[model samples]
Target chain A: MRRQVMDWLEERTGLETAVNHFLYEDIPASAGWHQVMGSVALFCFMIQILTGLLLAFNYAPTPGEAHSSVRYIMTEVTGGKLIRGLHHWGASMMIVVVVSHMVQVFLWGAHKKPREATWLVGIVLLLLTLGFGLTGYLLPWDNRAYWGTVVTTQIAAKSPGLGAQIERLLGSENGVGVVTFARFYTMHVMLLPLLTTLIVGVHIYLVRRHGIAPAPNDTAPKKKFFPGQVFKDTVAIFIAFCVLFALSVFLQAPLGRLADPTDTTYVPRPEWYFLFLFQTLKFFEGPLEVVGAHILPGLAIGALAMAPFIDRGQLRKVTQRTTAWGIALLAGAAWAGLTIAAMRSTPPETDMHAGLVDAPEWQSLSPEELAGLGHFRKQNCHACHVLGEKGKAIGPDLTASATKRDAAWHIAHFKSPAEVVPGSSMPPLTLPERQLNALAAFMLQLKPGSGASLDSAPDAVVNGAMVYQQQQCGICHQANGFGMKVGPALNGLASRRKRDWVVKHFYEPQMMVPGSTMPPYRLPKQQLQDLTTYLMELPARAPSRD
Target chain B: MLAEDSETSRRRFHLGVIYTLMGTIGAALGIPAAGYLLVPGSSNRKEEWVEVTNLEKLKAGEPEEIVFRRNRKDGWKILSEKTSAWVTKKPDGQVIAFAPSCTHLGCAFHYDEKHKNFLCPCHTSTFDLEGKPLEGPAPRALDRYQMKIEGGKILLGAVVKSQES
Candidate 1:
């Protein structure tokens, strides 16, 4: 009965014949494990589609709710974390697989002649994969998403005369805003997928039209696709997918703090896959920026597309095609070297597990705790004590103190420092009831390895640190057994002078200390505050028995 | 002939491995996706006592509707939903609170001061001073909220449904 039904369907649709042709087609016996990359790429694409569809069910595209909705998927929805993780990691996996497939095809001289269309379409598909990443990146609407796209669109804006137009087309005419969100969402979920599907259809059709490229200079008999080639492809896909699943299980996709357009302190970095391009742009700044931002990338992609035509020689062997092989190898090495350099130079992402930067924890701080952190900085508490990686070690490290003391003790200490600890160097804070509670609340939360350091410090302090090094303040003033003794020692300077005196000294160096021929430094008031804050960190002198 | 036999055996082994690998991958994707798609039944949120109004505001034997905002964690959002409850201070210095909704149809019910009874406007469901059904289509007595008084403030907990009028 089933045979008759199949025969009826076959007669009507010719489906069985197509399936038989697809399953039993002759592949070159020379085709081995290396040739499995194309099928593995196809598998990665399928995984992306599956996970992407699942993610679409929960993701909201609106600016206000996008970040919160992603948080909901991670924390609230059932198995949503895993699903989103798979989708997130799956994107990177697809890029890796597609690029590997392209590399394999190029090196094997599989892109020559009849398969040239296949190779060109594959390039288009690679661009689509990258397009997917760029668009999908902004959908989360977090700080990273907002800032990264700002940088990326700015890069696009560096395209010579068409810069502004390209920038407007990529992002909103105004900036990254409501319109940009809508445009990115549309491209990520709808436009890119549709274009990719159509192009991939053409790509696969071309692949089948010209059967698998025979191994270079091979005369071995062809093998059936059903068992040998399919088996190898299946194994490759299985291993690739297992690795993807492991990553999805182990490493969560990053969702940074909510998008803060006002946050100018953020240093935006692109996803790792695009880091090579980003790193290249770093080298060509100012007038030559166009070379790194546009010309180089454009020329590289253009050269890649014209590769088959450039090396039109009939020989496919690597030894026979020395010049082409040399160029490809050199280009690949340069690209890889740039990517590695970028990875090493760029700051590690604010991953919770990375234990490097705890920006997310700052987001999770309670209102009172956040206010307390504010008071700590505003009070210049770091001048006397170390907390996390910031602050001087003049007093007790607050991280250890926080672990040892309770909130009550912290509150009492903040209120009357002398009363709480006899002969304590800390001045009586004498803050209001609310501020006292908040300061204590903030102090009690500090612990060793909290990952609060330079990034978390208010921008002024960070800028001050940079300015100090830039101005070479250490060249004259001796501090901590470093630099020259041309000026007064900086170690106990904070105890001897007030902040006002330091500011006055910067403008009129001889006024604070007579007969001191120090050069008066002219700088902006903000820079002066930064420099003062930087200098005010001198260790206080210990009490001497009178 | 021997080489052909060996090749056939190798193909058979490969076929076995392919099936096993495919099965493992299918389960890896399918299990999570199935869990993701099939949302479980809504579980109850942990009940917390929230301040409603001061005891001074509740007159003896009179039900005063106290409206307050309750902050609830709904997914990633903290939503402040405005909720109301019926509070009565007994002549004996005891306080009783009833949920604002009608026991029958979940409509907001109000105290009909003229009749000195709780009334559901939609169905004219009435309950007496102790929340016993006096008239109309209420299925049971009005639901009472677990109540406590702390520092002169009346605190209310999750609603407790009455079995009988």
Candidate 2:
């Protein structure tokens, strides 16, 4: 594509091409293909820019507003998806084409001699382009994009000197905690695009001045860009657009869960093209870390900028520039490999005793979680945790438990455990004062159930209410037709089950329903008694006519 | 053909260069010029206090409805005939005007006898007699309007941004 463009611009250059081989001593026999590819990539980027701007007018960047705003675009904007979809695919294509451009440059040894300045400037353009792509990566504010950027910035802090400082400058210290999504969102839409366009002008200017490097082996008459290469370029671009359209229509980008700051399990990772650099930073863990993370990349760029000056060599053919090409190949491979490995890698297992309960699963629980066996037994926790061994093991066997999670993790897990620990047989616990402090402190320490007491007699009605929303029994079992139809109505369940059996059944509802959606709820002994006693004794709230 | 053609081309190129430079300068100055034109040409004229409620009609402690209007020269020049607001009269002749909207979530907070506080059913963020957060997550107190008594009725000042802290 670029060749087609250059062909049009330098149509007159070939006037003397047949006279002397001075312009391109090594224009390849198949130099035509390279021009075709560049033309394709240029059009893709323009699509991204245009779509991104249109989408910007409707997008909101704040943490609270991000998700709702996106919903509005999807449901409200007339053909908003076309605009958003293009912006999305455009970003993806930007990474794709930029990479393809780099590869073409690298494989051909276009970074040599007279083209050395061009090669260096092109490298800067690549980095700037990637930076633009990454900043835009978070604008949709989906859980994946938001967390992915957060995780990337943390890795960026490994850059030494300015790493931590820059992280703060990016607004982390200002308590970006939940707000960083909004901050990155604004930069992605408003700031980075503006900077990208300005720098793009410079990148293109330098390209025009130095001109494209010809392919590796030509000792004949050079071709004219206009009318000849231009036609070829247009044909190539048409093909590329056809491919882009196919991709946009056939493979829509998945919109992951909404931007959930509370979601710790969201493993942050950038788009695939960035995987190599992202992964490589992992090895820079200690003192040499700065070298791998920042210094090396910087030195590589510095070398690029200094290329025009370094090789005072008398050669014009990039085919002869072995050393520069070698360096470029190594840098590209390093980043690509590192990011790939990072994507494949998983964090090492943690210990429950380690005090670093930052484990993904554990973050959901508060200090008062009924994960303690005593609370669990009262809540009939093991009726499900014990799993195939029969009964409920409300709290899964604590054996090797800490390996999967951290302490703080327990906080997030407990909120609506169904959200965190979905299929486990444990019912969700909804406690009411029942020796609350004692249970929080001692229940976990006691065996599954040591018969914990309550603050008072069970208010069966309130306990029944708890059972409804907590078990999300309300979600499925419509007591009289309000809940999801997935489960049978619980309206008359209290009238059906016997007292002792009802008590035991309440211990673990899953025992009856083979594939129940309910999780292990470690209710305290009193609350358990309260709920069972309440449900068993209910006269159905006296059908009020009002 | 040598000297004459070269001389003409050079002159044309110089003139082109001059025109481009002048055009660039004009564009650079265009932004500020546009901004200047958008602003109001002069200072704001003094505003007159409008009558809100009858002084004798309002009783002590009991909030009375005050309705009035204001005339201004600038934006919204037509005299507004009437608007309603709550006014409290003091024995010494001080009148306080306040909006009925609650500060917390913007729902009107009614006095609850049992709780002895202004209760909000939404999340139960209770407020004190002065409409401050007594129980819930309200960041600020209810807004009180700036006002004064003139002739026989209370006059309300312009609404301004509140510094909740």
Model-by-model DockQ, in order: 0.27, 0.02
* lDDT, residue A44, candidate 1: 88
- What digit string (tens of lDDT, one per residue) describes model 2 on residues A424-461? 54445676443233234332332211122211223353
lDDT, residue A363, model 2: 17
Q: Which candidate is the best by TM-score?
A: 1
Model 1 / residue A455 / CA error / Å: 26
Q: Assign candidate 2 its CAPRI class.
A: incorrect
Interface RMSD of each: 11.0, 22.7
Per-residue accuracy of model 1 over B1-165 as CA lDDT, tens digit each: 999999999899888988898899999999888888897523234455666777888789988888876656666555757788888899999999988899889999888889898889889989998898888999899889998876677768788989963
Per-prediction RMSD in angstroms? 12.5, 20.3
> Which 10 consecutive residues of model 1 chain A have the lowest summed lDDT?
A537-546
lDDT of 2 by residue, B42-135 (tens): 3233343444556788777555545554443332122334445556666666666655555667765555766656666766777654446777
